[model samples]
Target: MTRREEIVDVAERLLERGGPEAVTMRRLADELGIQAPSLYKHVAGKPEIEAALQQRALQRLAAALEAAPDLPSLAAAYRRWALRHPRLYEIATRLPLARERLAPGVEAAAAAPLLRVTGGDLTAARALWGLAHGLVDLELAGRFPPGADLDAVWTHAMAARVAAGPGPGVTG
Candidate 1:
C-alpha cells in the first residue's frame, strides 16, 4: 500500500479502538513506527485523515444501501452497518462535513442510493437519513431503555416512510 493508505489504515484501527479522540498524529505515527512529521508527508494532518475516513465510511454505507431491495431493507442495512462500526459512523455523520475535502461526487454518490429508493424525493430522502442517523446515534450513546425492542422501532419508522410515499418535485 502507499504511505498515505497505510496512514489511513492505521488511523481507522485507532478509531475503532478508541473513537475519533484516540486518532492522534502522535498515536498514528507510533503505530506506524515513524516520526509524527512523517505523517504530514503523507497527509495534511488529522482533519485530512478524518476526511479520508469519512469518504470511506460514506462509500461503505452507500454500497450497503445500494444492495438493499427496499426501504425496510435499507434501514436494516444502515442500522446494522452503523452499529458494527459505531465510531466510524459517528465520525462520518456526526460532524460538519468538509465537502471540499471529499473527492468530487463522493458525497453525491453516497446519497444516490437513498434518493433512488425515495423516488428522488430529496426531502423524504433527507428525513429518512435523519431518522436513521438519529436512531443510530441514540443506540450508540446507550440512550435506549433496557430491553427496548429497537428492531420494532426501526420497522415502524421504515413503514411510516414507505406509507408517506414520494413527495412532489421528486429530484434529489
Candidate 2:
C-alpha cells in the first residue's frame, strides 16, 4: 500500500480502538514507527486524516447499500454494515460532512441506490435510513433489554416498514 493508504489504515485502527480522539498525528506516527513529520508528507493534518477515513467509510456504506437485492435487503445490509463497524458507522452518520468539503458526487452516489429503491421518494429513503441507523445505534449502545433477539427485532422492523405500504404522498 502507498504511504497515504498505510497512514489512513492505522488511523482507522486507532479510530476503531478509541474513536476519533485516539487518532492523533503523533500516535499514528508512533504506531507506524515513523516520525510525525512523515505523516505530514501524505496528510495535511488531523482534519485531512478524518476526511480520508470518512470517505473510505462512506464508500464502504455505499457499496453495501448498492449490493442489496431489494428494499428489505437494503435494511439488512445497512444494519450488518453498522454492526460490523460501529465506530465507522458513528463517524459516517453521526458526524455530518459539509457538502462543499466532500468530493462532488460522493454523497449523491452513496444515496442513489436508496433513492432508487424508494422510487425517487427522498422522504421514504430517509425514513428507511433513519430506521436502520436508529436500530443499529440502539443496539450498539446495548439499550435492548435482556434476551431481546436483535435479528428478530430487525426482521420485524423491516417487515413492518414493508407492510406500511409507503409514506403519505409516496406513490410507490
Candidate 3:
C-alpha cells in the first residue's frame, strides 16, 4: 500500500481499538515506527485520517446494502454489518462529515438500496432507514431487556413495517 494508505489503515485500527480520541498523530507515528512529523507527509492531520476512514466505511456499507432482495433483507444486512463492525459503524453513523469532505455519491450510493426497496419513495426510505438504525443503535447500546430475542424482534419489526405499507402520501 501507499504511505497514505498505510497511515490511514493504522489510524483506523487505533480508532477501532479506542475511538477517535485515541488516534493522535504521535500515536499513529509511533505505531508505524516513524517519527511523528513524518506522518504529515502522508496525511494533513487527524481530520484527513478520519475522512479517509469514513469514506472506506461508507463504501463498505454501500456494498453490503447493494443487491438486497427486499426490505427485511436490507434491514438484516444493515444490522449484520453494524454488529460485525461496531467501531466502524460508530464512526460512519455518529461522525458528521462536512459536505465537501464526503466522497461524491458515496452517501447516496449507500442509500440507494433503500430507495429502490421503497420504490423511489424518499420519505418511506428514510423512515425505514431510521427504524433500522434505531434498532441497531438500541441493540448496540444494550438497551434491549434481558431475555429479549433481538433477531425475532427485528424480524417482527420489519414485518410490521412491510405490513404498514409506505408512509402517508407515499403511493407505494
Query: Which residue pairs clash in candidate 1?
Result: none
lDDT of 3 at 28: 93
Tell me the lDDT of candidate 2: 0.84
Leading candidate by TM-score: 1
Q: Which candidate is the best by lDDT?
A: 1
Q: For every model shown, what is its TM-score relative to the native structure?
A: 0.94, 0.85, 0.89
Ranking by lDDT: 1, 3, 2
Better of 1 and 2 by lDDT: 1
| Per-residue alpha-carbon lDDT of candidate 2 for residues 115-164, written as tens digits (9 for 90 to 100) | 87777777888888788888999988899997899999888988887887
**Tens digit of per-residue lDDT, candidate 1, span 48-107:** 998989988888878877888778888888999999998889888887898988889889
Better of 2 and 3 by TM-score: 3
How do the residues 1-172 of candidate 3 rate in per-residue lDDT, one tens digit apiece? Answer: 8999999889888988897789889999999999999998887887888888888888888899997988988988999999988878877887786558887898899889999888878888888889998998888888999788998989898988889777665564
lDDT of each: 0.88, 0.84, 0.86
- For model 1, the stretches where C-alpha displacement exceeds 4 angstroms are none
Winner on lDDT between 2 and 3 is 3
